[model samples]
Target: MEQLLTVKKGNSRTTKIDVEGVYYRDLNAQLRELSSKGIQNVQLLNVYGQRYIGTNLSQPMEIEISGTPGNDLGFLMNGSKITVYGNAQDGCGNTMDDGNIVIHGHAGDILGMSARGGKIFVRDDVGYRAGIHMKEYQDKKPIIVIGGTTQDFVGEYMGGGILIILGLNLSEEKTYRAKFVGTGMHGGVIYLRGKVEQYQLGKEVGIAELEEKDYRVLHDNVNEFASYFNLEPNKILEHQFIKLFPRWLRPYGRLYTY
Candidate 1:
């Protein structure tokens, strides 16, 4: 039978669990050991707001979380797949290196901050700073997709990586009014599927009509997101997308001296 362990409430708010006797117990050490031993498909029960649920898994293992998970749910995850049935708190997939994190519900702030690789899909709305400080590396690019409206600073200081904000819940009129959407962004792409009037792009970046190449990338990302959340792919492609990129302003040049 599969292992199960209930954490004992202690003086500290954090709960600690130790596993034993079962295939996949809740013990911190054993879980890692089993994963290291090439075990796959671990099931977790009653996981209420637990932090670091499947962090840093060296091997490719599937973890199904039943309840809501706390902040940093998949901190620095290497090569594991985590599916959260409920909502997730702040920093849901902070600094993830590889693999995928699928949240059936909403997510909190800084969802994928500084993530180097991997993909994060949120079926619902998300809080502020969803993809702040995200950078891209050769052969390994990070991508974040939000189904509903996102809060301010959606793609702040993003050196690389692809960020797609689909305003499914809001009207087309007010979808692209996020504050500081691409401030200090130097690389990668930001595709917004709505009528964006504010146009608060950073001095280093410029906005233009998305070309066929850009739409192909956006379509791939959004299609994967739709499949993960069981949405209609064709409908998501109906809207137009605006592509944002760095404007190539020379730093420490005449602009700053003035």
Candidate 2:
């Protein structure tokens, strides 16, 4: 285990770890150690299916991952940036507080469940419940943007945050297939660039016209999303978008109130 990871010698600010065949616990311990040492940048190579790759990372550092990571990639993270070169498994950013996660490929289920703050950008599709239960805490707000479509219940029970689905991979004539979107949602917003039928939405959701403030949010976030994947922000913003808002606060409160 000790020989598998090599620390880059003579570089005080930056270090590289060859995390090939190392256990997840050991890898994380090394990460915590390096972060405490004030390492500004860390690169992980050959990281195949390592779960909890960036858990409990509170420092403002950068991580470059070469291979696919396992579930809960950034669980409970704070104030860091992680860029994945390959696909990530389920629960990519589960319950993260503050940070940025950039995935170059697709991700599995529950992409950003219960995230309080941070931004997650996936260049490809994600599995079921992509942004479930994201909430705002005081001044913190979470944001998630997907370049492709997601599976069912994309934002189920959302409390607060911003979610954008560009559907850049889908044909213009096709509609997003995620059904029951925003089911049980009481807060937050979703912006979609492609088509979705009214019947596909949950009873609690309603499509609203995009206001000026909405456009500004789209322009800024889409610009950053575009910059990550080498896309044209103007071309993306040229397309018409639909805004989905929760019809009211606590959409299901009546069921429990009386």
Leading candidate by TM-score: 2
Q: In lDDT terms, how accurate is model 2?
A: 0.90
Q: Model 2 compared with the native: what TM-score?
A: 0.94
For model 2, which pairs clash? Answer: none
lDDT of model 2 at position 237: 92
Query: Relative to the true structure, how large is the alpha-carbon lDDT of every model?
Result: 0.76, 0.90
Residue 237 displacement in candidate 1 (angstroms): 0.6
Candidate 1 residue pairs in backbone clash: 19-27, 204-247
lDDT of 1 by residue, 1-258 (tens): 335443333431212232223222244455587677766666666666667767856676777777777788778888688888888899987988887899999999999899889999998899988888888889789998888877787787887899888888877355555777777777788888775554666666678899989888988999999998889988988977777776663422555643
The regions of model 1 sitting more than 4 angstroms off are 1-27, 172-177, 249-258
Score residue 88 of candidate 2 by CA lDDT: 87
- Looking at model 2, report the run of 10 residues with the lowest lDDT sum: 1-10
